[model samples]
Target chain A: MTAPNASPVQSRPLWGAGKTVVLLVGAAILWSYLGTGSNLLLPFQADGRHQVALFFSQLFPPNLSASLLTRALRGSLETLAVSIMGTLLAVLIGFPLGALSAYTVMGNRRFSEAEGSSAVARLWRRLIYDGSTLLLNFLRSVPELFWALIFIVAVGLGPFPGVLALGFHTGGVLGKLYSESLEALDSRPLEALQATGASTLKVFLFGMVPLALPQLLSYTLYRWEVNIRTAAVLGVVGAGGLGQDILVAMGLLHYQDLATFLIATLAIVIAVDFLSTFLRLRLIPS
Target chain B: MAPSIEIENLVKVFDGRVAALDSLSLQVEEGEKVALIGPSGAGKTTLFRLLNCILTPTRGTLRLQGCDVTRLSEKSLRELRARIGTIYQQHNLVPQLRVAHNVLAGKLGRLSTARALWNFWDPRPDGDVVRALTQVGIAGKYWERTAALSGGQQQRVAVARALVQNPDILLADEPVSSVDPALAQEIVSLLADLAQEGGKTLVVSLHSVELALAHFPRIVGLRGGKLYFDLPPDQITAELLSGLFTRCEAERGVPERVLRGAVSPVFPLDSPYDKA
Candidate 1:
């Protein structure tokens, strides 16, 4: 028999996780009561709407005019500018915050002592992340067309307003991304830094930031690609871009020209995606 | 003649339910090496936390070198932290950074914040990093990352980091408990050397009583938030150790392997540690 005092600790299941799932299911049921079942309020233009036959005919021509391709290139440039500006803004702001947002001061790490005493710090960190996340949710929640519409009123729609909206919205997203990367970092370095008497901030920059950087930059670039697409749609709000030009072409019933704009946009987005993927891979240390 | 650390009725409660450290009291003379041993909960870890000033006592007195720490301001407390260096059982060294960076970290509290930030980009600082590494017998691998080394080497890096601080008091919690037999002895010997040769007052909490008695001349046995035994190695009899395993018949035997019925000489005067 073991020593009398060496009794096993009472084994209990971790109850908190089970209760959260139950609460989620209950909340969903309660929320459904206030709403109508039909989703007809959504703006989904069904198949038979808006020149269905003629629109296809226009698309069949697939505007490949040399002169038109060059004009389409200008619109693509605006898209590129939006993605570049948005991703840069997001990366610069998000990277450090991601590290701070991590569980471990060294990026998503679980330190022995920090795990016990850092509940308050953890709450504050989660609050900062969730607050920024809500901001991004609000921004993305409003479709690019809405942002463009508002910006058209405030700043006179151009690629500029599209860039502004993407920068603000994606900045939040990238921050969350970067913080996640920061949190997941190896914590030993931070402790090593701590042993030397380095403050929290110093530990983050030296130990956490370098480790999370490639992933943070990569995520920001991916967001930039989305921002570029959003910028194209924002043009419909008088926010000047390919979207505005497409609007004019459609309004004039220039099916061939609209086709050209669509094809060119697809090509540019593809190129941007390819380049970003390559660079992100290259930036990581093996 | 001054006491490096003084404690009286130190208590710590977590969630106001679990008493991590109960009303405990102790004192450490300047340059003396002390090994604290207990089963698991004898409040050894909590007492170390209290002495390190990382965790404040809910109700007690802690005076370090004539300074009343119970009422120290935030700035004064941080200054106090800078003076006391800590080494954990698991070397909490950052894996990505070079060994030199971890060693240089020991100087951070003494450096200005601006200088510290600048060091992140450029961690090298002349002979300071090399000298620290040399003291720990890891001089050739300063450029390697902290994790690339074996467990013992990493612990040595931790020692180098602490040595860089030039601390007045060294606190190592379960220092060599994680390593293998030979390496554990090496770590204990290093810590002992730090106390005797370097003359830094050191306090280490350990689970192995053999390692404790083998190295430290002074051993403080804790049981249920009380001191079960506090005596020099010369005065420690089998009967005193019997109180430690009062209820366990199997564990009550003399565990020292140097010689049967041997007490003090299991510890050497030149190197007071087990070889194997």
Candidate 2:
């Protein structure tokens, strides 16, 4: 049992795909740097430092006037509502689509053929899978800001449009995450149930659903955190939230008011992040 | 009555090249108890899967009761599958779910999709789940998390799942492999007696030749996806047993315990069939 090539590891070439990837990544970074005309020292130059100091000076002494404080509070509430409602809508739209798009959720034709499923049943499964996958692709491809613009035109300007924008965009994101997690679920339990003569639907409901749920919930909570950030800025397109107030302050040169809204945005994002992280830990422990 | 299981020159090829089962033929009479013994990769599990109708053969014919499974309609195949139960070595229960729900999962074939989904959230008290748990001596852990149970107890839960299915045929694929030897003997005896009392045809694959001979009336030895010997326990000699496990131990992936078991096939003749 003596090895013919005891030092096989050392003999083998180490500079292959790993080095190629590092070279490609390095090239991409260099290309981006030149393409964007990025200047690393720009912020450290004298004029650059003065500009930065002026910006910071304006950012302080936030408007703590009672009226503006009340407005900020209202804006925060609106942003929170948009995120929660948007996420709820996303789940309603994404869950079914995600389930359909998952590779393992729909029984494959070979198994179905063995079971003697009709041609029509097979076609129906194919259609749902392909259709949902394409739909999710289209939904997520467009940015939330773009969706907000379209939604604002259709529904007129309000938080409702922002909710719709976030819903449509995040639905695609959550749908993809949901499908991947579902696809990655351990197939053993599902196969075992299928062996018991359970219908595909029965197996899915009992086996796949239970196995994938914790991961799905974890993904959804994570997506909700992302949606909060998007919702805050969705008002740039007149979709109404803390973002609209911040934009108005920026346009009017109300730096103090802008500072208050920025603080409010950060506070809300941090709050939502903490809440979702808590929920994920409590609901889906590793 | 027609044989409960019939396989005529069944061949199952994996990935177009690896023949998991090659031209293997076997028959089990109604209510007969059979144990399959072999090295790892001997196609014992593959044969069980084919019998369970979860895996279709690449060639040859397979019949359950009297119906050819290959020709059964989707609905008919499901109906046929409902009449068979399987217990795996890993006991594939959904760990996040309650034990009672996992047990009731055995009845998914009979339950409507809506009802099955509802049962997960609201597992209404079912006598069969309770009875199966009681039969396997784990009734107290019905509402407990499945993952919370010990390995041996989890195996019992798997047996409970198969039992709750109330099928006419039971396939146990190395169901007791993970447990200690004493618990393995207990589970094997439990499976044999349950099948006997219910008059269901039982087929189990075993790693230990001693357990197979001690519990089952008929022994089937598989090697390299082919049958080496099929004989009553008393008729199986040490030479034939060794041929199945030792000749190609390294190449065939025969585990050490199997070779060890082959060395000492002697066991007390306490098989229920002996009483008969």
Candidate 3:
């Protein structure tokens, strides 16, 4: 019997495969120069490898002295405090901005003649929405490190500066994420509440908040984890934390002390990550 | 008593192009129970939205409880809306909230903002809410998350919320479409009974011609965004339904067989209930 007729198969290259490879190779060359202060070719030199080996050897048998341990513990506690305060402040700042920025929550409902018909009302609503979005974009666009430096100058070097920096930067991030979550929510529930004559605030509280809360909380927790690491880095600019201790150790060429601080920072990060994960799993239903 | 709803030349054009409702006009007496029946895209939803004041008419006038809806200020419109309760096809309860919280939301319009905020935590399931839940046969689910409820039960919760609102007029937009056939009949009957017993004016848009005919005394048929017939159920004969739906063939430029095939299921010719 003759084989059943089948359409001829055609093979095509994956979309943008050649361009992606070229981009990746170019990025690698650029990144090597930026990260190593040397071109890709220089890293393969014999003397370069020996220099790396010598630098790494200095970190062996990390400082385990009682005095160093005490300093590390104090720095670790300060870092934790900075992260918690920063995250709390971020939530306080971000939640309202996010609610205001979300189109479903604050934007004029399209096709709603009462609210959307008038030119002035529409313009007012658009201005509020666009203004809030612009503010969030401005806040998040500046790096946290820059904010930390600015705060350091304003407040004088301390954990306060680190907290403020993380709070400002993370507030923007959380606001963006929160608005997205709110916008993605089902509008039917809000309509149901509105049909009952609930005011805008009431509708948001009863309808939007319930649906958006779990995801918003999840994002907050994730940001807290990120802030913990960011807070540690802020200390490099003399914003108090483990990063300050690490910076000092590196300045003094105390490689062992630097190694100890690095390990302690890693441990703290892992612990915070685990705790946040546990809380998230418990709090947000799958 | 003032009519529950009064419409004159109501028109709703979407995106300034597609006319969803075309100069429709009708009046419903206080406490009257009526069913709106139509094929898909027949302006039933637009009419319901207009009645509920969720949508403002592009043209013409709609008066509810003798008040001109188009002329009302935002504050007055809200007060008017507070007197009218609407149930959507999807239950529209916050899935993350407990059933009691969803039911309690009905009182948000009347409660002060501070009190409403306080009630979010307490959600005391006051007598009215409990009674409404009981009326819908879901009192036991008061503390359960709304998302955990099945489709029919969620619909029941929605009904309970509407009942708690205790509005003068109730509008349901395909309230039982997602429910199974048996449950659909039961829910419609429940809504009808509740509306009658409470003396609330009821306007329900339905996809099922049989359910509308079987339950409602008055049937309003709509097609191609225009009123087809407003008659007592007895006057709605099979021939009228066939004629009403078949007109779409000319408007849509679809073949006769295809139109007949699609429309037959919605307005069946040989329905056993027709003889009853």
Name the best candidate (by TM-score): 2
With candidate 2 superimposed using the best TM-score fit, by how many Å does residue A12's alpha carbon deviate from the native? Answer: 9.1
What's the TM for model 3? 0.87
For model 2, state the Cα shift of residue B170 in Å.
0.5
Error of 2 at B183 (Å): 2.0
Q: Residue-wise lDDT of candidate 2 within A1-286, one digit each (tens)?
A: 7598686466668688989999999999999999999999999999999999999899889999999999999999999999999999999888888989986776464232256777788788889899999999999999999999998889999899999998998999899988888777665576678788998778777777888889899878988999999999897779899999999999999999999999999999999999998888889857
Top candidate when judged by DockQ against the true structure: 2
**DockQ, candidate no. 1:** 0.18
Candidate 1 local lDDT, residue B34: 92
Q: Look at candidate 3 and tell me the lDDT of residue B265.
A: 18
State the weakest 10-residue window (summed lDDT) of model 3 chain B: B259-268
Candidate 1 lDDT, A125-149, residue by residue in tens: 6787566555655654665556556
The 0-to-1 C-alpha lDDT of every candidate, in the order given, reads 0.67, 0.84, 0.83
* lDDT value, residue A94 of candidate 2: 88
RMSD of 3: 6.7
**Which whole-number lDDT from 0 to 100 does residue A267 have in model 2?**
97
lDDT score at residue B173, model 3, on the 0-100 scale: 82
- Span of 10 residues, lowest total lDDT, candidate 1 chain B: B258-267
Instruction: List candidate 2 segments past 4 Å from native.
Output: A1-27, A107-113, B249-276
